[model samples]
Target: MSSFDETQDFVVVGSGGGSMCAALVMRSAGKSVLILEKTDLIGGTTARSGGVMWIPNNPFMKAAGVPDSLEQASTYLDHVVGDHNDTPGASRARRRAYLIQGPRMLDFLIGKGLKFSRIAQWPDYYDEAPGSSVPGRTVVADLFDVNRLGDAKSLLRPNFLNLPAPLEDVMKLPHVKKSWAAKKALARMGVRALVAKVTGKKYVTAGAALQGQMFLAARTAGVDLRVNSAVSQLIVEDDAVTGVVTEKDGKPWRIGARLGVLVNAGGFALNQQMRDQYIPGSSTKHTSVIESDTGEMILEMTRAGAALAQMDATIGSPLSLPPGGEEWPIKPGAQNVAAAPHAILVDQSGVRYLNEGGSYTEFCQRMVERDKEVPALPSYVVFDSDAMASTMIAGTLPGARKPDPWYEQGYLKKADTIDALAGLLAIDPAVLRKTVDRFNGFVAANKDDDFKRGARAYDRWLGDPFHKPSETLGTIGKAPFYAIPVIPGDVGTMGGVVTDEQARVLREDGSPIARLYATGVSTASVMGRTSPGSGVNIGPSFVWGFVAANHALTVAG
Candidate 1:
């Protein structure tokens, strides 16, 4: 429907953060670029995300005088991810390469006019996990002005779950302990700040901000952009990627890249078969809204001879299944509840699992493991009235402008006694009572013998600092107890077509698949097992896009 079409030098697929970064990078280099988005509107899952792009040892970190070093970062990664011994060489190699080049990529984008803000308070997910830092690792993009992109607005996706709100506001929310306090505080402070923010609105998050800023920079460099083109398949010549077969206005057209095909298309989170196969017992409850995110591109790459990396691995977190789906007992819309300060995660058998106060991925993985060992994945987060009081929770800051709808939805349940609530939840009464008694004892003693809930700095970051003997444990002795069901969820899947450290697609034999590249959720993550700090996905997306750009440029040269 737009002006540009058909003849173009480069065709990038999927408008997620990864694809946008690649498109923008190539565009800025004075290369003709066309983004072939499958969906009518572009912005992929990243648009609907928290929009924080984590880059460690970045210029922002240095400028802020926050202490960090590559040695420290690598050490921390090594500690959390463990040895790369039996991993794919490409995965290991890409991570090493990403770490080395991430700072440069971050600085390059900043230099190219992408504004970045330091998440100074956001600590590494595992600050106590081997080589972790207390802070100075996670960086977020400054709220970008969406109006600057002109016609690109139509192609952009709505900001995901947290919309019409900024990260500053989304961070503040209330749970049982601080629900009323947070409600009253937000009423007092959220309105003025929100009004000011919108009037001076700057959009940020996922690929939109990354791509928007990059797209603006690229346009300044005179890159040609064509939207509404869907890539049907790859054009291969003599065993190398030559271009793409795309449909414009419902007409087929062959476009020549003359350089490379960058597969920044997102992963297969929405692919039902893939989800069922890789992520067991999860297809029914996925949280990804990018319906166009099928594994077609990944399939295309595999057919083109690209080796897959860690295809079984995924980024997992707890998500509530919609009311109709059957998998496990869950309280739908629990995320709407203010994340609790004194909640303890319990398995279906009414037993505590891993430390509940951890990264979404870690928590989900623990739940998965627990379910695999037992029979169900649904877990309960239990808290008391005092815990539901005015304590500053991890994700919910008191002054958050945007209210989490989950809280307003009554995903949380309140009752006068533990046994009474257990009966409602179908939890075994005797087991539930004993678990609460033990957990309360741990709260009083400031120790969680069962799961070591708050024993580490990483766990403490998302926990209540003011809570008594145990910062992570809160006694549920107060009458009118509360419980919310949690399920395994995720930002997106992480397995995909294997690519070399240069961001070039590679074959099973490890030979580069010429003119083919991928990044973001399109490829397996560079970080293997453990998720480091925030923005881990976005930071590398920028870096690999830069890498892919240079590789494409080299081919063009």
Candidate 2:
């Protein structure tokens, strides 16, 4: 047993959005806070994410002239999430709490000097739903200069860091060919870039910017942030979580919490055992989350008598896995490469199983759903020369001079003809040929009969607007076809310790565990089984973290 060395007024596990927000809120309320991060770097998986937070009726949305209401949001959630008993995830009360508190949390962060802007072009994942908006309710942090963070920037988790421009600029590039407004947006971005360069500031965008602002706020508020400290166990007294035992420097160190302990240490995306047990049949090797999300906090919370919910859920997506067990890191928003024109995803039997232009989560769910009947563990993304030339195919750059090394390494198969490519992929040649022929007919007719591929607004968003009739439809008639294997990969696991509307960890019998709180992927997701929109994961996380902090402060007072 490790002996107690010190005590804090409040202790927060994990250094992601939830934990950082909680720590900052508590510190602002005149409470001493300590944030323990399991990995050497802070920020957790939130730093690697898209950084968009889906908050309905937020002030930013209102300021942008996008109308939204709690009633409409509830109706939308009812359609997407359905019944709680059937979904077995976030309760209605919890959903209501998130909708109500989300704006307040955003305002709180703004007051703390964090800069955020509404993403005016991004739409809800299920835009056809009753409460869905075309110009979404999502907001993202502005590009932040690393110089503002000073020495603490080195301790933050690194993001994929693909597009250095602001998200508004990045989003406009796809529509530049069709919209004059998009071209103007790009020109504005160019000016911003020149200004940043002249100012001698290195700006980071997306998830990195969001986490950077939170980290700076936490440091400025006097939160005791510790990295390379893994919380292994919780200290309980009278059935209440009073402290935590962490593995630091190859030795166990115990630290007590006088107010409460909050577990926001992320999910088990990197733990093979947990992946096999919870999200079986999904490829464990293709997850996009950081390697540090091993569910240690889930185990610690469970050991402390917390109940679990939605263990079978994940924030899943389709990912290209290279051969020889090598992993491909995809930046946030890059998964749309699969939805580009002329590409079609097919199962082992060479059958199209889903809308090719659907959300990544929906695409992965289709892969899993089809796996029950056929061998769909590794689906093939097939595209032709036109697709390779016209747009990026599965993260491959557009107009590449030659085949990538992925082809030489057997991760990608290429051939001069459709039948030949199917043979190389070990798929039925006849089925694949017929499937492509039918898909070509759909493109020519400007309508998809089977899965309605390019029918939705979200589908068209991923496609080339310059294309005729539909943006997502283009004939795969060009020769020299290519195929790459895609698997069921995830951003993170969606299940963990159960928490109520107040963010208090709950027991199996529906009783709240005293002095224990949870948020982020460390608790059951408030979005239920479906992703409502971009940043749904981080939005409720921030709100619940705020709720937990305020509740703990009230208890302490």
Q: For each candidate in turn, give its C-alpha RMSD to the true structure in angstroms.
A: 5.0, 2.5
lDDT, candidate 1, 3-24, per-residue tens = 2234566667876776656666
Q: Estimate each model's TM-score.
A: 0.86, 0.93
List candidate 2 segments past 4 Å from native. 1-4, 86-88, 172-194, 247-251, 323-325, 329-335, 400-404
Over all chains combined, what TM-score does candidate 1 have? 0.86
Give the Cα error of residue 352 in candidate 2, in Å.
1.1
Counted clashes in each candidate structure:
26, 0
- Model 2: ten consecutive residues of lowest lDDT: 325-334
